[model samples]
Target: MPNNPPIIDVIIPANNEEQSIGHVVREIPGIVRSIVVVNNNSTDTTAEVARQAGAEVVDEPIKGYGRACLRGIAYLLNKETPPGILVFLDGDYSDYPGELEKVVAPIIHQNVDLVIGSRELGIKEPGAMTFPQVFGNWLSTRLMFVFYGVKYSDLGPFRAIKWEKLQILNMVDQNFGWTIEMQIKAAKHGLQYREIPVNYKKRIGTSKVSGTVKGTFMAGYKIILTIFKYL
Candidate 1:
């Protein structure tokens, strides 16, 4: 551990989340050194709203969840003093941004390489997650445990990781497989990881991936394919 407190930065990948991005950005904990919001080719005012909320906004014209996250990483890496820890969170308001401190606690104090915020273990409001979302998480996690021998509860979007370890993962998923890809690679690399409970609520708007049948199917297919692709 460094003599000084480790710097922590947050990355939020947003697409057409103008209505909720500001709240997400503003609710993030004060411990974070910086907040970078990647506007993923949104036709709305997501970028402006995030900037107005005192977050650094970067544009990712190509719309993919992982692509937006990668852009945020690139922005951070270009900095002279990149953060020691990087947190990934959705721009949607479902996640409790204030619990970021709890989410990163293990990495900050216990030398943990990764920390996943497990909504499955948390207090969730009614209708916070759809039936398909719940089922997908269950099946995907079970498959990962069977294949990779790592137990994961939910591939929740809110997560923290050591920046150095994260770069080593060479993350490349451009869409739905981003979170699972990270979890799978962490296990394969033998990184120390933990899941901590984090409360969830209904998002400010409909979920892009789960609100529609087509989106849900495509996301599920991509996640399952990615799981097998790595095997």
Candidate 2:
């Protein structure tokens, strides 16, 4: 470990996740100094419940995964004391929030700059991932390798990165391509990256992306477009 422990922050982008955001906020490890849950135009009680569960809630009236994430990032940028390491995860309670310790270990102890929590490399509960999600990850990562020359398993949203390196990524995607855009930018900037196994289970509610036909199609299309856009 470093002479002083790293200050950690977590960002969760949620929309109408009133049923699950609280658990995601509460289960995160104590090493985290802040949990910023971005309510992405939620139609329900997500912000209210996230605040009740000890998280700092911010509102992003614009509805997009990347928009919510960027909102949280902007909030952190204005923090009097910024984080040493920043983690991004979903608010659907699909991932085991307690596993954040394992997610950031490489950054904490091994000087790694980025770590992706790969469900493919980890235990994923049955039905946790839809067919399109699995296919999209495979295709997107394959394209990344073919084009960007970086080999990665999945475009996982559950990832940890050094705060400084994250700033260098200059993430700009505002919708479905957010995760892929981050990974691509990280590779372009030559950040040291790793993939660690993480447990995944059924989320508390329907997935906005993989749960709907339009969502799945749009997500897949955007991911492919994002890969080529940066190429």
RMSD of each: 1.2, 0.8
Clashes of each: 0, 0
Tens digits of per-residue lDDT, candidate 2, 35-127, equal 999999999999999999999999999999999999999999999999999999999999999999999999998999999999999999999
What TM-score, computed on C-alpha atoms, does each candidate reach?
0.98, 0.98
Q: lDDT for each of the candidates? A: 0.95, 0.94
Per-residue CA lDDT of model 1 for 28-119, tens digit only, reads 98988999999999999999999999999999999899999999999999999989999999999999999999999899889999999999
Which candidate number would show the highest lDDT if scored against the true structure?
1
Q: Would you give me the overall lDDT of model 1?
A: 0.95
Alpha carbon lDDT of residue 81, candidate 2? 92
